[model samples]
Each structure stands twice: as structure tokens, then as C-alpha cells.
Target: MTSSSFLLIGFIVYNLAFLMFVIAILGRKWAQDNPIEHTRKWGNYAIGATIIGLAGHAGFFFTRWYEAGHIPTSNMYEFMTFLGMMIIVAFIVVYFIYRAPVLGVFAVPIGIIIIGYASVFPKDVQPLIPALQSYWLKIHVTTAAFGEAFFAVGFAAGLMYLLRCVNFDSKEKGDRKEQRGVEVTIFSLVMIIAFVISIFGFNASGYHARFANDVLYTGKDGVEQTIKQNVDYVLPPIFKPFEGEQVEMKPFLGMTEAPFEAPSWMKGSNAGRKLNTVVWSIAGGLILYGLLRLIARKPLGAAISPLLKGIDLEDIDEISYRAIAIGYPIFTLGALIFAMIWAAEAWGRFWGWDPKEVWALIVFLYYAAYLHLRFSKGWQGKRSAWLAVIGFMVVMFTLVGVNLVIAGLHSYSGA
Candidate 1:
């Protein structure tokens, strides 16, 4: 089968599995009269479908690798695709340990979401740059992805723990309106949906916001980049910066003589484009959240909690910690060690403290602290779970944000 065909099949299978898990979550009461047993069976059914999806994903992976004559882990599309698969791998491992049915409900959807997010980025399989044309490419990227996948699972478990345990009752904290875990869950969904929407909208409309002024800024490679004013891009700048060239320009509405000026430090590409993306995301997210709230007539977290009521919180906590513990060493070896070694060969230096490297260190240290606190200071349960959640956030920021910002030595992503 063609690689595209394989990927299409994989997408369908995973979405099917995701649907089944959702059904299993919501239909537990109607399944077999016993809630726990029925959901477990439903979760298993989802897993069965997930296994089939995984096979298709593997087919897609190998086919792409063969067609490209290299490991398919270079670009955002490739790495994110592999990362989705890793989440499934981590799910299988955790399931084997605790046999938690709730995990399938959470994990399968996560895989689907990840793969879906990956589809938004550029999908071309370009030839590797000189720096990435090494055997270390396979080792570093693959291992780092695997480690991050485990961390993703830990995030899932940690989130589930909070969703299951936290009371949904409203409480005021100081002068601000305090939100519950379920509310936060909705916010997260909004953000994800927003991101997807922004991606699609920008790509589909080919909308480009015009910059008001030409500006000179340094790129990640430390080269001065001249962004001429009155250029069109997808994003708009959030705030105007005083730096850069201030050339006179006509406004879109013929309102001003000078073009808009924004600092390059704000984002990777055009500041106006980045800003446009964020605005689109926020607008899209808020709309989706409002619809969900209207349809469910309750906070999403509150709605999901009952489905997970019978799940053992202790099991969730344990599995989350185990995932991090196992993943930490692997992440350390691959993302840091292998990464540094590869950097040394490529740039003739070990570490340059690039944005990517800094974020990598941040991810590693966050998890390291999590372990230290969990083991030495006895911070498990809620505390450890929160740490896992934050650690995964750091991992994600490194994954998506770094690539988007075009930071560090990982310029191969754009290649």
C-alpha cells in the first residue's frame, strides 16, 4: 500500500478506537448492569482496536522509512507521528501493569489527538540536512521521542487522577473566581481545539496579516533578519516593539503613514502572523468551550468524573509515577546525552545552550526534581501527579514550541 494510504488507514483506525473508548466511558452503565466490569470490557475493546491501529501505524512508519531511505523521525510531522505511537506503547505498558480500563479511555484519545495535531504541521519528507545526516539521528530522535511518550502517559494519568479526585463544587479563592479540575479540563480541550482550528484556518484561508514596519532582528542562527514592513502573514503582533527599522508605509485601511512594528523575539516567523494565529486559536477555543458547556449543561470534568468514579486513584498515582521513573533515565540518555554527542559532531561543540537545549534541560530537571521529591521527600499522590503534569507540559513546550520558534540546533525540523 502507498504510504499515504497506510497513514489514512491508521488515522481511521485510531479514531475508531477513540470513539469506542468514549462510548465505553459514557455507556458503562448500560453495558452489563455492572459499571466497573462493563467499562473494563469496553476499554479492552478499545484496546483491541488500538492494537489494529498500531499495526497500521507501524505499516505507515515502515513504508515511509523505506520510501524515504531513512528513519522517518526528522520533521515535525514525522517526530509527532512517532510520538503518538509512543503514547500507545506507554499505554500498553501501563495497562499491563495495572489493567486499568480507564486508561484506555484516556490514552487512546490522546493518541488520536496527537496524530491529529501532527497533521497540522508541514508533512513533506525532505532530505535530511548535513547535520542530521548521521546515524545519531536515529538514536537521539527515536529515544527522545520514546521517553517523551512515557511522560505523556504520566500526564494522562496525573490528569485523570485530578479529574477523578477533585471536587467540582465552586469555591472562591481570594478575589478571583476559582475553577475546578473539570473546568480546567474544558480549558485544555479548548486550547487543543483552538490550536487545531488556528492551523487549519491559517492554512485554508492563506490569510496573511501585513506588518506595519520593517524590522531587523536576529534569527536563531544569530544572523540578522530584515523583516520588511507591510508584508502579509497569518499572525498579528500582540504588542508593538520600538526596535527595528521604522519605514513609512500605508495602512491596510489607509489610516496611518507608518507600518506596524513588532519585535522578532516574540515568535519565530512574522510577529503579525504569530499574533494572528494566537487570536484565531483563542477565538476558536472560546467558541468550542461555550458549545461544550451548552450541550453538556455541566463542566466537562464533572461529566467525565462519574465515568471514572470507580477507578482506583492509588493505581492512577502509581502508574503515573512509574511512567516518569522509567522514562526519566531514557529521556536523560537520549534527549540530553545523545543529543549533546550529536551536537558535538555537528557543530564541533558539545552544548551551545540554544533555546532547544535550554528547554531540554528544563524538562530533564523538572522530572529530576519530581523524582527527588517523590523518593526522598515523600511527595507522592496529588503532589507527584501535579509534578508529572507540569513535567509533561515542559516536554510538550519543548516539542511543539521549540520547533515552531525555529530555535537551537534543531533546524532540521524545518528542512
Candidate 2:
């Protein structure tokens, strides 16, 4: 099969595994089977399906790498898919160690969501830009992404622990505070789902909006000059580019123009377009979250927490900590040490304080502090789980937010 076919197969089987995992958890009360036997049977089936799916995912990676004549981690699309593959690898490791079928209930969905998110970006194989043409590209990027994959699994386990332990029915102040935090965590995930849905929905409808902004730059002769650049938006234009005018906009909701201009301080590459996408994602997320809340008649976290009945809280808490602990050293090696080596080779500097570089340091330092707190202050259970969840958010911002919202030496990767 072709690389695309391999990807399709992986996607299909992953969904199958997710269904099987759900059955493993929720089907224990069915008719005559012992609960343990029921879980074991279906969990084995789910794990078997997961292994097959992972093979297809790996096939897609190697085949695409051969076709492109370079590693497939250079751009957002390829990197996200690679990250999804590594998530499965990490999950498999943890599943075998814990023997917890319910882990699949949380982990598989994260892999599916990440793969779906990867589908939102362009998939064409492009020639490497000069800076990315080094052997370190494969070493540094793959190692770092593999480490981040463990963090994704850690986020899943951590979130699961929160859902399992938090008292959804309590009115105590501390319990209510934890409940709200869990609710917000669920909402943030919904926003990511909204972003993927909004992109696919708009692009499928061939929706298009364009704006032209005048950019001032220093010319070859060192004279100030201005040029107009076109910015395109697939979603409805909620805000125009900074000091930009409409080039074309399909009328929608009886509106022919954007109602606001991007703020002057928001001046990154395609900042207004990115801002508009963010607005759409948040609005769509609110609508989705509101509809779910109405249907469930409770906080979404509260609605879902019942699924974890009889689960071992300490087991999941340990899983969360172990996953983060395993990832920490790999992340240090790939994200900081190897990254600095590659940067120095390509740019003649170990560190230039570029936005990406700065954020990478921030991520490294944050996790270092996590380890410190865990070891020195005996921070465990809820506090440690919270740190794992928040640290993954930091990793994502370094991976995604910096790329989309900031222009620097690493801007090409965002493309």
C-alpha cells in the first residue's frame, strides 16, 4: 500500500481499538461473564488492534521518509503525525507495566485526537530549507517529539486521575475548586477539538477570505520601503490584519466586512489570520461545551467521572508520575542539548534568544522545577498530577503557539 493508504489504515484501526477499549471498560456488567474475564478479553483485543495500527503508522512514516528523501518531521503535519505514533509507543509501554485496560480508554483517544489534528495541515512533501538540511534534524526533532509523546500520555493519565479522584458532588470549598479546575481542563481540550473541526468544516465548504496589509521593511539599499502582502483566511474573518483592508470576502451572516482590525502590537506573520482562527475556535468550543453541558445537566467532568468507578486512584497517580519521569531525561537531551548543538551548527550560536529557543528553555526549566518539587518537597498525588498536566501545556505552546504567533529563526517550521 502507498503511504497515504498506510495512514488511512492506521486511523481506521485506532478507532476500532478505541471502541474495543470502551467495551472493555463499560461491558463488565453484561450477562454472564466475570468482570475480570470480560475486561481481560476485550482489553487484549484492544491492545492487539493497537499494535496493528501502530505498524501501519510506522509504515506511513518510513515510506513517506523514503519518498520525500528526508525525515518526515520537518513541518507541522509530519511532526504531529510522528508525535501521534510515538504516543502509541509510550502508551503500549505503560499499558504493559500497569496491566490497566482502562489506560487505553484515556490514551487511545488522545492518539486519535492528535492524528485528527495532524490532518488539518498540508501534507505535501516539500524541499528542506537550508537550516533544516542537517543530520541533526532527524536526531533532535525525533528525540524531542518522542519525549513529548510521553508527556501526552502523562496528560491522559493525569487527567484520568483528576476525574477519578475529584468529588463531583461535593460542596466543600477545596473540592469545588478542584472540580472547576477539572472542568476547565476538559474545556481546553474541547477547544483543541473545535479548532480541528472548524478548519475541516470551513475548508470543505471552500470558504475564503483575504486581506492585504502594507508591510514596512528595510530594502537592499538600507532604505525603508513598503509592500503589500495578501493574507488568506479559511474561517470567517473576525478581525482583519493590522492596518489591512479587505481584498475579498464572501458574504456570511449578512456581513461583508470584518468588524475590527488587529491590534498594532499583534504584528507577527499572519497574526490577524491566526487571531481570527483563535476566535473561531473559542466560539465554537463554547457552543460545543454549552451544548454538552445542557445535555448532561451537569459539569462535563462530573458527567464523565462515573466511568471511573472502582478504578484504583493511586495506580493512575503513579502512572502519571512515572510517565513524566521517564520523559524528563529524553526531553532534556533532545529539546535542550541536541537542539542547542544543531542551532550552533546552523546559526553559529548556541543560543540566540529567538522566540522558539526561549520557549524551549522555558519548557526545560519548567520540567526541571517539576522534578525538583517532586523530589525535594514531596509533591505527589493531586499536586504532581497538576504539574504534569500544566507542563504538557507548556510543551505544546513551545511546539505550536510559538510557531504560529511568533516570527523568528524557527518560523519556517510552522509552514
Candidate 3:
């Protein structure tokens, strides 16, 4: 009934669709048999569920628009969710054209992971800051996100292309390549899982670590002073302040700056903790990755390959390139052109060398290089696929990493 309800329904429906696609992939071989009609049934249901979820996601968007009296692209949660929606949209478009249900195995999960990533951010709607109060908020941010969504799908396709196309026969170079690729993918999945754990931990603990005005802290000079901080859901200081201290006065762990008392430039006091948490998660993931390999005694990538034996890797590789080709100009227009316009209006400059802007340029330029290398240099198979993979990581850093680590002009407060 309410927008929140619609949003929940959308999340649940999309997750259900995600599972269906996974099922379709697992049962695809069975569905091809004349006697048993299962994969088709699951595939159709997945597609239908995906469409319904999109509608529900749209409902959430519209409801937020109505509630906020503006488009919902002004913050992390809204824009990130929109990005996830666009990935599914891109997948659907490709599906209609190619009829490749195999892509859905990777495509839907990519969207789900993105959506899951977005869910970890603060979800409450808040008034837009003065910088974001413009028509460009919708036009620029939505278009940029839509374009990057295609790129995200590009990453999925590229990964699929690599997994499906690589030669993995024992005692061969292909096997070695697949082993390395699988490690990277599995490591990525483990990082995601760790992030999910952090979110779950926060919710289960009802975590709210903040500092109101006049909060006491020892400055870098070791002098106790009253300060203001807006930290939320942050890990407590690794080394707490002495008894009777309201805030940790310790400023550094060796040369590294301590994860407290966010710098004045940061948009959120909690940014340090969020960034630290991510680093810890990745480090933990690496340990798990090593452990998994030790236990399994083989490369995870090669292990997963047999499940997708019938997949057409060439189709995936082509589609990966196509996704980038289709999305590049749009990304250029929205992320670069319109973004510059918005920056000029908001910050009195066309380009500020902001971290986010720099990363956006990096993503664009990397993909451009991928295109040139693919067409002009004829770097088609593994090399091009690897480029696509890297391009999406750059894009993701622009989207998520810039917010958490380098606050810049972008407001990640309560994000």
C-alpha cells in the first residue's frame, strides 16, 4: 500500500527472480530434453518475476518522488537502487534480442548484488542539499546511472565470456588462466558476503554510534576539546579513549590516521569507519579465498566451469562489447557532459578535479581504450574481456568508493 511496501515487494520479487534464473541455469540442460519441461518453466517465471519487480521498483521510485517532491536520484540509496534497476533493464533488453537465458545466470545475480550493496546504505529519504536542488539532479544522475548500469551488465557479460570461453583442460595454459580468473571472481563474492555480514551485524545490534554537539575528544595536540561529529553505524574506536572520555582521543595507529574524528572535508563523520570496514572485509575475504583453495585443492573458476558447459562464450563476449558500445556515448553524455554542466551551476566551475569526477573520467577513458584496443588493435577475446572487467571496477569505485573514502563535494552524510 505504501511506497515502502512497494519497495519491499520489489526487493523480494527481484530476489525471487534472481533465484529462478540460477535455477534456470542449473536445470538448463534438463529443460532441453523432450520429456521434461523444467528450465523453460523456470526461465519464463524468472522473466515474468523480473518484469513485475521492475514495476514495483518503479513504484518505489515514483512514491519516493512524490514523497520527496522531487526525483529520488539525489542520494546514495536512491541512485544506487536506480543503478540496479537499469542493470536489469539492460539484461531484459539483451534477452529480448538474443534469447540467451544463460546470461541471466550472471546478469540477475549482478543486479541482485548491486541492489544488495545499495541496501547497506542508509535508506531513509532526506531533503536534498542545496547543491542537489536542480533539474540536472534527475537528468544528469539518472542518465549517468543508467549508462553505468549498462556497464555493470557489461562486467557481468565480460566475466561470463571469460568463464565460458577460456580453455581449461588439465595441464594446459587455459586451465591456469581459468584458475586465476575464478580466484578473482570468488574473492569478489567473498567480499560481498563480508559486506552483507557487516550490514546484518549493524541491524542486529541496532547500531548507532554518533556524537552530538559538544562531544568531547582529545585533539591531535592531545588537548581535550569539545567537538561535533555525525557518525552512524560505525565500528567503535579500535582503541577506546581512557575512562571518562566521551570520544577516543587517539588520533593514529602508527603513521596511519585513526578511524575517528573524520576530517573537516569529509561529508560524513562515519566515512572513515565505513571505509575501514570495507578494507577489513576485503582482507577477511582474501583469507577465506586462500582457505577455500586449500580445502578444494583446485582453482574455483575451473571448478565452476563444468556447470556451464553448454554456454556460448562467444555470444557473451560479443554482448559484453555491445553493452559497452551502447552505453559509452550515453555515459559520456551524462557522466561527463551533463555532470560538467551541473558542476558549473552548483560549484561555479566546469571541472573541479573532484575525486568522483576524476574516477568517472577514468572509467570512461578505460572503456574507450577497451573499444579502441578491441577494434583498432584487435584485442578481442580474453584481453578485451579483462578490460571490460576492469572498467566496471573503476565505475563502481566512482559510485561507491569515492563516497566512502574521499568525500569531495558529494554529500555522503547518512548515506
Candidate 4:
């Protein structure tokens, strides 16, 4: 009925699609007869569910856009949700092109994780700031997100290629290196999931903490003034703001206050809280990884490599390359060309070395290099797949890290 309802339906349906995809890919071994036919049947069910889920996701977007009287890409929650939706769109397109149900097995879960991560942000619709009040908001942000969505698909395929090909049991140096890289990637993903889980877990228990810090700011009168800024934390404070006073804190595990202060170099509005989140995510990820290792009694890669047994490594490698190839030009247009045009209109400058802008350039150049090496240098297979995976990380940092960690003209989007 409502946008939120539509989003919930989308989330649930996406999860169903993921499950169906898992069954489609993994069911072949368990099929009573005609494994190919079994996979085809379940794969069809998964794709159908995927389409239904996309409809719901689109419903959420359009309904929210109608309710807000603006495109729903102005803030963290809306943008992340839209990004997740676009990822689904990209996945669907790739699915139809390759007819690879296995792609769904990895890609759908990424969309789910993105939406789940998005839920951590505040969702209340708010009026756009002057900077975001432009037609380019619709064109630039959505295009950028859509391009990044394809990159997300590429990451999924690249990861699948690694898991499908890497020798998890071998003791050779190169094999071990690939194995560790996969493990680290898995650990990073676990950290993201862990952070989402921790946020929800603490929020459910009504955990809250606040710290007040005196920050020096330049006044309009060309004078410096000290202002007291308050930072809130939903998770426990492992590192308090530098020279901050405790406003309010809830004791947890006999910990009454943060054990350390954030480094002086960290100087954003919520740098300390962000740092603490990073720390917590790492700790939580290590714990989760350990639990998983204990259960499987081996590296996580080794455990996952089996599901990909019958998969052709070359096909997924092509999927990875093609996805990146298609996404690169879109990303260039949206993230670079359109972005610069918008920036010039909004701030009267075509290029500013704001952290966000710099990172956007970095993303553009990184992918540009990826394409050059892919087409010119004959870097395919493991090399190209690794590039695709790492390229998405660059895209993510530009989208997320620049917003949250680095204070700049684009910082308003973080709010």
C-alpha cells in the first residue's frame, strides 16, 4: 500500500529469489533424475521470482518518488536503496543475456546486502538542499548508480570466477596467494554484513551513546570560534572523539566509557564514531569468520568452491569482463562527465579536488585502465577478474567512503 510496504515486499521477495537461485544452482547434485532439467526448472523459478522482486523494488522507488515530490536519490538511505534496485536491474539484464542462473546465486545476495546496509541509515524523507535541487540529481545520480550496479554484478561474477577456479587445497605459493585474496574478500563482505547486523541488533535493544567535542571553526567574520558538536552512536563507543566529553553513555559488558580517543588526524563531524564503526566491524568480522572456520574446519573459500564445481570458469570470466566493459562507459559518463557538468552548475566549478571529486576521478581512471588492459594488454582470466573485483571496491569507496569518511561538498549526501 505504502512505499515502505513495497520496500518490505521487495526485500522479502529478493530473499526468496536468492533462495531459489541457491536451490537452482545447488539442486543439480541432489536432483533425482535429469539434473539439467532440474536446474532449468528451478532456474526459471528463480528468474521469475527475480522479476517479481524487481517490480516490487521499482514500486518502492516510484512510490517514494511520488510521495517525496522529488527523485528519491538525495540522501544515504534513498540512494543506497535505489542503488540496490539498480543492481537488481543490472542483474536481470545480465541474466537474460547470459541465462546464467549461477549469476543470480551471487548477485542477488549482493543486492540484498546493499538494501540491508541501507536500512541502517535513517529513512525519513527530507527536503533537498539547494545543492541537490537540480534536474541533474535525477540524471547524474541515477546513471552513476546504475553504472555502479553493473560493476556490482561484475564483482559478483569475478568473485564467482575466483571461487570456481582457485585451488583452495594447494600449498603452492601462487595458489595460496589467490586463496588468501579470496579469504580477505570474503572477510570484507562479512564485515559489511556484520556491521549491518550489529547496527540492527543494538538498535533493537535501544542502545544509544553521545559524545560532545569542541571543534574549531572559521566564522564568517574571519575569526575562529570553538563550537560544541555532539556525535551520537548506536553501537558501543570503542574510540571517543578527540578531546571529547561524554554527554551520555550506556554501560555494556562493564565498559563505562570508550577506551581510546580517535586520532587527531581524524577530523570529520563524526570521525570518531566512524572510526569506532570500522573497528567494531573488523572485530565482528573476525569473530564471524572464526566461527565459520570452526564450523567448516577449513578456509571459507574451500567450503564455497564446491558449489561451483561444475561451472565453466571461462564463461563466468567472460561475464565478469563483459559486465565491466558495459559498465565502464556508463560510469564514465555519469560519474565523470555528467558529474562535472553538475558540479559546474551547482558550485560554479567544473572540477574541484574535493575528496569526493578526486575519488570519482580515481574510479574513472581505474576503470579506464581496466578496459585498456583488458582490450590492449590481453589481461583476461584471473588478472581481469581480479581487476573487476578491485574496480568495484574503488567504485564503492567513491560512492560510500567519500560520503561518510571524507568531508566535502558532497558530504550533505551522507546525511
The candidate that wins on TM-score is 4
Per-residue CA lDDT of candidate 3, range 1-415, in tens? 7777887888899889878877877876655664135766777888899999989988988998898788887777778778888888988887777777777888887877777777777777788888888899888988888888888778888887777766666678767766576567667876876676666665676544433333568878999987765443344333221121243232223522233443444334454465556666676677767777788787767666677776777788888888889899889999999999999999999999988889888988888898899999998877888888878878877887777677577754344
Q: What is the RMSD of candidate 1?
A: 4.7
Cα lDDT tens digits, model 1, 1-415, are 8876887798898888878777777786676568677777778888888888888889989999998889999887888889988888888888778877677767777777788777776777789888889999999988998899889889889888877777666455621122353366557656776677666766676533343554677898999987755534433333333343323323334444224444556643334444444455667778888888889898777776667776789999998999888899999999999999999999998999888898999999889899999999999887787788777777877887665545456755741
lDDT of 4 by residue, 107-126 (tens): 99999999998998888889
Q: State candidate 3's TM-score.
A: 0.85
lDDT of 3 at 6: 80
Predicted structure 4, TM vs. truth: 0.96
Candidate 1 similarity to native, TM-score: 0.83
Q: TM-score, each model? A: 0.83, 0.95, 0.85, 0.96
Sort order, lDDT high to low: 4, 2, 1, 3
Clashing pairs in 2: none
Listed per model in order, the count of residue pairs whose N, CA or C atoms clash below 3 Å is 11, 0, 0, 0
Rank order (by TM-score, best first) = 4, 2, 3, 1
In the range 27-124, model 2's lDDT, one tens digit per residue, is: 98682558899999999999999999999999999999998999999988899899999999999999999989998998888888888888877788
